[model samples]
Target: MSMAAPAFNLRTDLDAMWLLPSLKPRIANQLAGLVNTAPAWMKNERPLVSFSFDDVAKSAAHSGARLLAEHGATGTFYVSGSLVGTHSDYWINADRDDIVELIRSGHEIGCHTHGHLSIANATPERIFAETRTNTRFLRTLEPDLKIDNFAYPFGRASPGLKKRLATRFHSSRSTRAEVNHGRIDLQLLSAFPLMDRKMTPRVIDRILDRAVQTNGWAIFYTNDVALQPSPYGCSPALLAYALTAAEARGIECAPIRDALLKIGAERTF
Candidate 1:
């Protein structure tokens, strides 16, 4: 039997405008960062970078993944099961075949909840159910898949949800726009956006440079990578530019799982 469609529409409901310069969300996110932290010490000799795609758009699964592969790198694709194979106003979601191809091609399949709901607005029960449904659906496609990473939908999180997720995932990423270094909160790992509308070569250089200087982990996240990308997505050229910049700096690019292993991230709860 096919899974039922989620009531929320990703095209409309996923907008994070409320998170911009808002005192409430800003305070909430800051407060969440202070508590329920699963701290990890990052120990590595060289800088590390990871490219991750949230929601697994068709272009991301194809063009974005291809670009990474061309660079001899792999990325983490955070999949929301309900959106798989569905069409949004901006782009189409990756189907079962695309996901299978990603797995076969050695990409990491991360979690983004089943309905793409923001954890800040979800009840505890709803959060559990969403994760369970998403994991179950993902395993149906690849029974042996090990989904150990998660990205909060819309980059929203709370202390309770963060605590709950820490038990289930090896690491959870956020849209905090910073590089991970030293002592990091694994429950809310900081990540920068690679949006076409907002990113520039200078900005990419600055972020990568900081990672190299600090010997840190730089996790860059984007959605669809196409010629004309959505506001939240980046163009193929921009994606390639970031990858090439990272490579030129002698940074090692890998999926989140592999990067974590290489960096020797150890949890200190």
Candidate 2:
């Protein structure tokens, strides 16, 4: 099924906003990278790759998860409880059944907070409430579900949020584009985009090659996988190409939780 085309180019709008004269957003992101770091040592013996979906659009829950399973792989789906079964402007969010099925099918379900609020400036109390609400909602669907990891909504976070989340989650991913290598920040892992407009065969090859060269963890994130996708999503063909390329390169594809355990990543507190 074709996704509705967005009213405006999402990427272009984002770029324009980020390029504003103040450059505050860029500066804040840089600061986020440097501060509130919960360091972890990655003693990986091989390259690792993790495919994740943020806000988990319906297509991603169905098509994206199916593709990963077909490749003998599983992905992490970061879900916001409030967004579940809701229709957004670009795509529909995954429903409760999708969440249950994901867990049943061996995929990881990470927290994206209850309201999908950006925690960049949220108070600790608010952050706690949001996460707790989300946990409770998810557990309602699957009693044994353990939401271990988290991803920042809109890829925005503050030092205080990171510090607080560190205590609650094993790891938290940001939208920072890079291959995580050597000493890493468990609270703020970097991830590359798997969006339709951003990823290409050559780009995928380069990313995989870098991960192989550094024996690093490469996490690719997107929202949906459909023939026609939102700006933040990718086509199924693109997703397949990525999975196939990773397999060819002998990269071990895993969910974030498994990857962390495999790498023996211990908190440096």
Cα TM-score of candidate 1: 0.89
Clashes of each: 0, 0
Q: Candidate 2 — worst ten consecutive residues by lDDT sum?
A: 20-29
* Model 2 error, position 131 (Å): 0.9
Across residues 153-222, which tens digit of lDDT does each residue of candidate 2 receive?
8887667678888878889999989999998889889999998798898999999999999999999999
lDDT of 1 by residue, 79-124 (tens): 9999999997888999999999999999999999999987456654
- Could you tell me every candidate's TM-score relative to the true structure? 0.89, 0.88
**Residue pairs with backbone atoms closer than 3 Å in model 2 (clashes):** none
Worst 10 residues of 1 by lDDT: 17-26
Off by over 4 Å in 2: 1-27, 267-269
What is the Å distance of residue 126 in model 2 from its true position?
A: 1.4
